[model samples]
Target: MPTGVAIRDPREQLFNAAERVLLRDGPSALTSRAVTTEAGCAKGVLHRHFTDFDAFLAELVRDRIARLDATALLTSAGSGVVSHHLTVALTDLFGSVAVAIVSLVISRDELRARLRRTTPTGIPLLTEAAAMLGSYLAVERELGRIDAGCDLHVLATTLIGAAHMLFADRTGTPPDGTAVRRVVDSVIVGALSTPPR
Candidate 1:
């Protein structure tokens, strides 16, 4: 057993266990039984906490999105090289756990509908990411790092779309940090105007 697993709230324990199962065995293996088994709790524990498996999954997805939002909040522009900051933020956002959760949600319609009903705005994670990226780019533009003429929304959307593909390419291992940085640099440079020579 892990250090904190035994002490945390039951909901958190279940969530963490579900994430572990998803990451270790992929989305198909993330059943209520698997989650409870990994959590070292009874099968009925999840039912007692959440309305059903879909409800639990919905809450888990929302919790993960909230965590990603918190991470985005830490990525302020002008604090570091904008491309590097953006790369790090995107990499964290598209991590293997996130990818697994997304895959599960896409394959499970009941969970998807549950999530849509529970979230206030019903906006998906990718849209939220794009919005965060756009805000970061706007701040960078104000600091003169990005071109004034560049459309922040379009650039953010493009970056998010590319990142989606990069993350979805689970053919073998994920793209390394160097590859992610190169892609971020290319995107940023293409969107920025040449400085005065």
Candidate 2:
């Protein structure tokens, strides 16, 4: 690990280093200097790949999103057990991508200086995750496993919001399976009560 001279291609090495830096140091450590240092590259390498800080952050988010999406896929379509998925997917995202997202969103200065341009305009991650839930709900609703009227939209929104809040530690504690289950079940049952005919 020689400084100023990288071992592998700087691009791959930097991306790998970015993940390591993000995990060990969180989103706050994702500066060009920090990432290059971690990757054993000169500071200019970041600029060579990305146009600016915003571009780098954007790439970081993209990197994280891909990983989370893969995780959600693995969690996969199952029993539509909200508690199960919540325990696995949301919690996992919180620890990983969501940590960076939350950290960026929480800090006004950081959000403006580093995140505003890079971060998506709205809850893209949540929307994606919710859509995952919505897919499950669609199946459940079709099978009559859950309520038909559950407004998958609302359920998705609620789940994403609750998940974000929980991950941000806004509640002062990580949300538990029971709580997630209860809310999800309530929505399902409510949706079920509506006349499907």
Candidate 3:
């Protein structure tokens, strides 16, 4: 709001503001001005930190990707029910601004091109999400929980894709936990070395 007022962690502030705009107004409504206005900071603050709006958006997507935590998923490989762990992880992922961020990336050509320099292949948020699941699946395979011959890459991608669709478009509320668990269990059933729980 003020040109000279101190704002600590502008990048995080801007990122949060952008997420709000993206979630509330959708990708078409997002702009440097929109983000700055949402953040209550000067529009020049965005330019000072990023070469352009696309650059800022690229970092936002990357930052979201970095925040996808796989620790619980990885550690649950041998102990917890595989399908249950997967359900929780996928549900948590889609419950965030991820669906909106994915939509934002798809709507912006320049942003996508800029992201490609670092990502090189696949959509940024979705690809990283697939990788997170893949890593957990790999751990399960190592522990003999998942079938030896199952292609984890495909499984992981399928899970992310299916889960994304489930959470992508909705009116009032996210899909119920039972709905999410059904999707996770359906995708993971054939891959489990043991019978599905």
Best by TM-score: 3
Lowest summed lDDT window (length 10), candidate 2: 188-197
Best candidate, lDDT-wise? Answer: 3
Candidates' TM-scores?
0.83, 0.69, 0.96
C-alpha lDDT of residue 180 in model 3: 93
Selected candidate, larger TM-score, 1 vs 3: 3
Q: All models: lDDT?
A: 0.77, 0.60, 0.91
Q: Candidate 1: where is the Cα deviation over 4 Å?
A: 1-8, 69-76, 118-123, 169-171, 193-197
- Model 3 reaches what TM-score against the true structure? 0.96
Superior by lDDT: candidate 1 or candidate 2? 1
Pairs clashing within candidate 2: 147-191, 147-192, 148-191, 150-191
- The deviation in Å at residue 1 for candidate 1 is 24
| Deviation (Å) of 87 in candidate 2 | 3.3
Ranking by lDDT: 3, 1, 2
